[model samples]
Target: MIETDAAGKIMFARRALFAVLFLVTMVGSLCLAALALSPGGFGIFDVVVLGLFAITLPWMVAGFCNALIGFVIMRFSADPVAAVLPAVELVRDDDPVTASTAILLCVRNELPERTIRNLAPMLEGLCASGYAERFHLYLLSDTGDAELAIGEEAFFSELIATWGDRIAISYRRRTVNSGFKAGNIRDFCERWGNRHEFAITLDADSFMPADAIIRLVQIMQVDPKLGILQGLIVGLPSTSLFARIFQFGMRLGMRSYTIGSAWWQGDCGPYWGHNAILRLKPFTEHCQLPLLARDGEIERHILSHDQIEAALMRAAGYHVRVLPREDLGWEDNPPTLLEFMRRDLRWCQGNMQYWRLVTLPNLTLVSRYQLVLAILMFIGSPAWVGLLGLATAALALCDDPADVMRSDIGSVLLLWILVMWFSPKIAGALDVLLAREERRAFGGAGRFIVNFAIETGYSIILCPILWISHTIFLFGRLFHRDINWMVQIRDDHAVPFELALRDLWPQTLVGCLSLGLVMYSQPWALPYILLLAGGPACAAPFATVTAWALLGGLAARTGIGRLPEETAAPEHLLDLALPAIKSASRPPLTSSV
Candidate 1:
């Protein structure tokens, strides 16, 4: 018995060492790949391998690090820890003097009028709060097109004129959209950051209850070390079936991960660009625009600038926190499957950019690992595909089937992959029911099943689309292609089937290839292959089906089976969507299209 126990311990230690060694090798491979990017470059295959190695290493590291951090914090920390609200100390609202806050809403070309109108309720909620006197609203527009800019300006002006001092309103339009959102915010800081002690940054489509913003600011005042506080963003369901599923997944399953992440890291967790409050001085002074070496090509405006900026602040010894989604900040999600993919592809490019960061100097091991983990999450789909491909190829070429099975090794590897893939969702689901404020969003087991059906199905479809899109984005960077940073363009209406077919064809191709390969190489793997294939192949049908069901449900509820009406929106959301009100002679905000 003693000997068996000793053997088990030895095996565990060996696996740990293997994991570490594998990571070190990955780091080395990335360094070589990056080094190959000099004037004298390597061949296409070499560049591709190097690029993949470099981009993927961080994700691998981040997962390991997140687990390790969870262990340490859970074991060592003496604080009341929840990922969303870490160390929730009882804060007294002593500041009866409603501190004035400038809610900075950054927007591009979209339905400015509709988005602004939707956010009216939230803004009204803020005004209803005693601190209404202290909260000022700023509509920052980056809409560059003449017609859209004109439309936005008029819409914003009317909104402000209509509101008439319920909230002090200001607007700015950037002439050239530099640095995406980060640059837009930086520009604001340079022009007027000093005007306010703190700024609440929001996406054009995002909204938070007035109290959440007020409370966040009050908490910031209490903690001097904090630089940025990220609020949990709940997804708002829309008419589209795709939107409904994503909203549920994000609100329930995904929210927990953000909460767990925030709880584990507290201030170390990076700032999400939207639905967050930030200290102006640190962001402007410390979060300088990253100079792009290839200018419009590689490293253009730091693709994931928000994460990078948060990393920079943390490295500089400032705190960045993830606040609980329980506070009620909601965001407009991508309404269609295609729109979701387009947005994710951009994210893939930015996440891949983190590889350049891991090699930079002065980062803590924890932060470096965090960047790596994020990278992994982005690239995991392709990596899984590639890994599966390699295993099949190896088995096909080899004579001994038993040798190929290598059941112990394959089983462990497969298990780890599954855990990494599904843990976030499971973690999130757990967090949803646990958080008092968010629990109401999710019902009992019935809602859980519905949410799962939508998320699992939608995520599967998105996998292949993103895998290809990210591959192209990464390939562009490797070959040094010029890439522009743009805000995710949001549309309220569903896209036509023709557009859906156009976007889905590539995913269909890869998924088909994967299915063919799995059948030929390992017939026993049929069930898994079909399971994965169902996501991509049936994506359109699934969405259509889901949408039909939702419509039917809505019809059953309302006497006239018409489309459901949009709920009253928050005011901060309106401020974000309304066109950039042109101040005295500045540049016009650019349109997203």
Candidate 2:
């Protein structure tokens, strides 16, 4: 076991290594950009391009650094999970569960039946663990719809009658969801937080098996210093083509990205607001967010509350860690492009609000950095769009080939940026490929490789479109547009061409104009411009087609973006009858289940 001093030394070394990798990439890339632009004698257009290029580097660099480290760990480590999360070794599976944990199921205007379906497995698992008494389940509702509230009440009453005796279970609903989810949780902490030693926060869409929940509780019980132990949450297998493809990439990207991050991030890791356990006492006392608005106002409240809470928790001297283990925690992602955009925009607004909270006192340097990184995560989108726009305009004005850049250096720089931009997924692919058993679990190396390529192209088409959405959103904030938290629509359905066109015209317009400028001024740059601007150009069609029911079913039939859960589900997940599991002809991946 690593001593406290030894752990601190290892943490320092890893962070320093990350810093070196990030700085090297930034410095080297800027120099390449300067060299490429220097050929024509750096002008205003060249200078602004370089500035935007620099602004875009951190996000990409962070991903590359994390992925590189993560890939190395996955490729080399005998036990990758332990390599990243050494604290896991402190607790034993058979460790006596002593602390009482509050299972916080935070929901707002959600379908109660669906929410209940996701909760039952965990309750049953807890009962089987013979530690059901140690866990209290709270169905905390923030439903605004009158009809939905009725359903929620009925569901809770039924759930309470059934499981109240088996496990300590209760339900509460706020008439007004004041601070949204943050408020919902704050209400819980104030009411029942002191009663329990820990709280496991779960969203309406989140699920954790019984053993996973028990393991987290045990880990926390063993380590009193751990304020937040965030489990890695993968997307649940889905029938929606958009969701499956989106999550397949997520499943691949988040693993290595998380492992790499946890290695250096140590105690200042992420809290994704769901599928994680938190110590309730310090959390209730110290993580209180400054309410943005008054008594009943909802619009002016905090939207992105998880990261700030994590920072505040760290500020209070408690460790916050993300466990980089897969198939333990799962969630249902946005089922279509439109829902995805709405969710992204909400977060963009929320992160922008952190400009005020980032100033909160007592935050550790790393905690402050995490807050800033959250802001940059959204800010980088506009930088990307701006860079692409300026380059397009630069091409439009250039008559001669030597007018803007030296082609060789420009090509190298573009390739470098593209490679780094896709580095997380690239590293994720390598992590799986390097492990023979991992490849088999992903339905063999060949299928996994093919899916990787398809998901990459899907991302290429989707990212820029979302970038435009994010760019527009940031601009709207300047004009005081009200972007508040809205209940997520989490069901499978086909997107109409009209709805896609209405929401995605900006992307299409940008794409069309970019192509026209390239063809008119410098015809040769069209191919290069297509790689950058083409996604938005094809946005409407991309959304409509991917959300088409027939296409989705066909994709599912062929297992185009088949996740491990779909290829062979856990026995526990089998009862959930996930789309893939329902369709599977094979056995589960886990022998014990």
Candidate 3:
């Protein structure tokens, strides 16, 4: 009890420190925003601009804090992972596998062949390690498409024939994915939750080795209070340039960001829906979805259930933790820019639903704060795009540029915002460069630095491109247009220009108009606007080029954005034969994309 109390106090102190730093950064940004907009007088336009800027600042501030803290812990701590998560010390190699676990793979119109391909190795590893008996495989599918269901049924038969004897394998499909993934899992909890002490959830794209799985189960066995334990889900190495470069940047920023977040967040860490282990009984009982009233009916469900589930689990007095390390878990990223936007929009829709649960009872303050942050993650897009529109209006309306805009303050604010926006990735790069082993793991300093630069440019262009998509979708959401939660294409493929144009025409139009107005009004500010606007203007070409087979093939062959897995292929990943890893290595196989 005393140790627990001390841990709680330590966690409180960390949060308090984070709050102070976050407030300082936000307040400073607001001051700069005010100075940049209203040097002469604070008009209605300036007030609105400030309001939008305020709305948009928290996400950036939180990112900056998480990145900065994560970087410090990563660089200074002797054993970074163990320092953040002391439970690491409890999991010894010989920790007995006493608890029964359910390997739950949820499918929704996904390719059964791909699912089996990913599952085969995991099953073999489990059997080889002699843990197969303790783990049962559940194919929790919600395939509404009849044709897809046929394929799934056939594949499940084959899957059963091959490995059902070694490890218990079962397949269950719902005609409709009523609650989507959360609903699918809820069904599992009702039918089979009692059978397993813990459940390891896997998305169609997600893959975990037997060792990672056993390690997680062991961690949970030791920590009775631990409800959910999430490992860092690295992107499976790809031949697609889009996934490769995108994940490289994500890899850099994610390490420090997650480490810092895990340090402060402690037990109340994030559960990213998949690539995680969950205690079955408590999750079933305490984490029930609250009735969402949409247009005066309790028919709606929470789209983004992981964060809320974490909050609920914490409220139930259980620790929701994340293991801040890579190589333990892997997932396939959207192979093209267009596919990325589609997936992002679904998340955008789901996260926007957090407004309904932000006030749920018994949740810790930090839990509620996380919900708010999740909402802001997507909502802030409108504010950012609003600020852009407001700036364009301010520029066009003013006879003199100095009337509504101050270039000196504006430039500083721009630089500051960019720094914060990219702070995590920058902090990550610094962490790698500072460490000899990490740098070498990323194919030495030269290759790592080159990858970092390319990823940086890719990110700058990608942010606004996604932001515009978010902006448009959020507005449509206001009018009751919702995105369909469909199966995402996991494999790499070429994105044709015509298809790119069809999807990104709105971004292109908005970009061109916004830039043209800024250029004609204030020609000098063209460069500044280009950072955000250039992306939207060239969204089509950007999408097409990023998905080009030849370019992607060349990048994979040349190790342009080589990850650790590509540099030194892991034992388990060798089987997958990831294009990038295979190209870089003598024979084999990763990042977050």
Q: What is the Å distance of residue 70 in model 3 from its true position?
A: 0.5
Q: Give TM-scores for every candidate, taking all chains together and pairing residue i with residue i.
A: 0.76, 0.96, 0.96
- lDDT of candidate 1 over 1-593, digit per residue (tens): 99758744764554455357457645654554344333235555335544554554555444443444333443345542442353346456655534456789988776676657655776787677756667778888888877888988988888888664787788789877777778788888888888777889888888677777777887777776788888777765354455655665555434435534554455577677888888778877887856655545534567678877787777777788876544457777776566676677677777777887886666655577678777777666565455434444543455554543444544454455445455556555554444443333233334444556557756666555566556556656678664454446564454555656676665566566667766777677666565445456555554445445455234222211111111222444444442211110122122111
lDDT (CA) for every model shown?
A: 0.60, 0.86, 0.88
Worst 10-residue stretch by lDDT in candidate 1?
A: 559-568
Query: TM-score: which is higher, 1 or 2?
Result: 2
Candidate 1 accuracy as lDDT: 0.60
Candidate 1 residue 592 Cα shift, in angstroms, is: 43
Please write out the lDDT profile of model 3 over residues 297-360, one tens digit for every residue. 4467888889999999999999998898796899998999989999999999989989888888
Off by over 4 Å in 3: 294-298, 586-593
For 14-86, candidate 2 gives per-residue lDDT tens digits of 8898889989988999999999998758788888989988888888888999999988988888988888777
- Give me the candidate number with maximum lDDT: 3
Off by over 4 Å in 1: 1-90, 294-299, 359-362, 379-381, 391-401, 407-416, 430-441, 482-489, 495-497, 517-522, 531-534, 538-593
